[model samples]
Target: MVIAWEDGHRSSYSGESLRWACPCAECRGEAGSPGRLARVQSLEADELRVQNVALVGQYALQIAFESGHSTGLYTFGLLRSMCDCPECRARKSAT
Candidate 1:
């Protein structure tokens, strides 16, 4: 997916990377416990298939995958940080 930031910077990400970075409780966990994704040995193709996307108020997006996982609330800030475009990469490395 591609995001056109208000600053006119465009950021892009692939479905595979997004699925790998899922921040849901099941994927990221809580109380210092390891998440399910962390314990998984491999990812199925369906798990990385983006089925739908929904806006959450004005700050985040909730994405659903074909594998039936949809609890990740990807905030704008997090999404920005995840951008791997050359500009974003350079900016991050310079910091």
Candidate 2:
């Protein structure tokens, strides 16, 4: 998905990456718990792309992946933090 931030910056994310980064309790585990990084796990080729997308009450995105797993809601803050552009990546690394 592609997002235009309030700061006039744009970011894009892959279906698989977003799925892996799912913030749902079932995917990421209970809040404050540790064991959430599933985006780097092994996944089928079809799960690497997005099929459809929906907005969630102006706060998040409900993406339907080709894999049929569409329960996660990605918030704007999380999406912004997931940016993989060169500048974002550099900023992340420096932090």
Candidate 3:
């Protein structure tokens, strides 16, 4: 899926990266465990491809990555809510 930033810049991420970055408890954690990538030593390039994208009802996009992981379903609203640009700005301001 294509993520459009507030700054008018858009980044196209594969389903794998999106899945790896899932906020779900199955892949990550409900109590906010950092993420699966946090445990990986290094990622191979072939692991970063979008295998499939299924629309979960009318709420979320269920993405499968090339690494054979398919669990987190990202909602459109949730994606917008979890935007890193604003969070990054806030972090910079605080620091």
Candidate 4:
């Protein structure tokens, strides 16, 4: 997915990366439980690709991956926080 920030910056992310980064309760699991990445050990790389995307009240996104995972509600802030752009990466490293 791609996002154009209000500050005139553009950000893009690969579907596979986003799938692995799902922030849903199921994906994250209980405080110390195994996560989605751990549970999905047999998945092929193609299974992580996005199949569809839907907006959630203008605040978030609901993405369906090729493997049929689609419960995560990716908030805009969370999406921005996950940006892998050089600027975002540099800012995080600086902190």
Which one wins on lDDT?
1
Consecutive 10-residue window with the lowest summed lDDT within model 3: 10-19
Report the C-alpha displacement of residue 82, candidate 2, in angstroms.
Answer: 0.4
Candidate 4 local lDDT, 1-95, one digit each (tens): 78897889888989877887788878888789977667875567666788999999989999988888899898889889999889899999999
Compared with the true structure, what per-residue lDDT tens digits does model 1 show for residues 1-95? 88899999998888898898899989987899999889997899999889998999999999899999999999999999999999889999999
Model 4 weakest 10-residue run by lDDT = 38-47
Q: Candidate 1 vs candidate 4: which has greater TM-score?
A: 1
Give the higher-TM-score candidate: 1 or 3: 1
Instruction: Predict model 2's lDDT versus the native.
Output: 0.81
What lDDT score belongs to each candidate, Candidate 1 first?
0.92, 0.81, 0.66, 0.85
Which 10 successive residues of model 2 have the least lDDT summed? Answer: 32-41
Off by over 4 Å in 1: none
Count of clashes, each model? 0, 1, 0, 0
Regions of model 3 farther than 4 Å from truth: 3-17, 30-35, 82-95
Clashing pairs in 4: none
How close to the true structure is residue 65 of candidate 3, measured as C-alpha lDDT?
Answer: 72
Show the lowest summed lDDT stretch of 10 residues, model 1: 12-21
Which TM-score value belongs to model 2?
Answer: 0.78
Q: Residue pairs in steric clash, candidate 3?
A: none
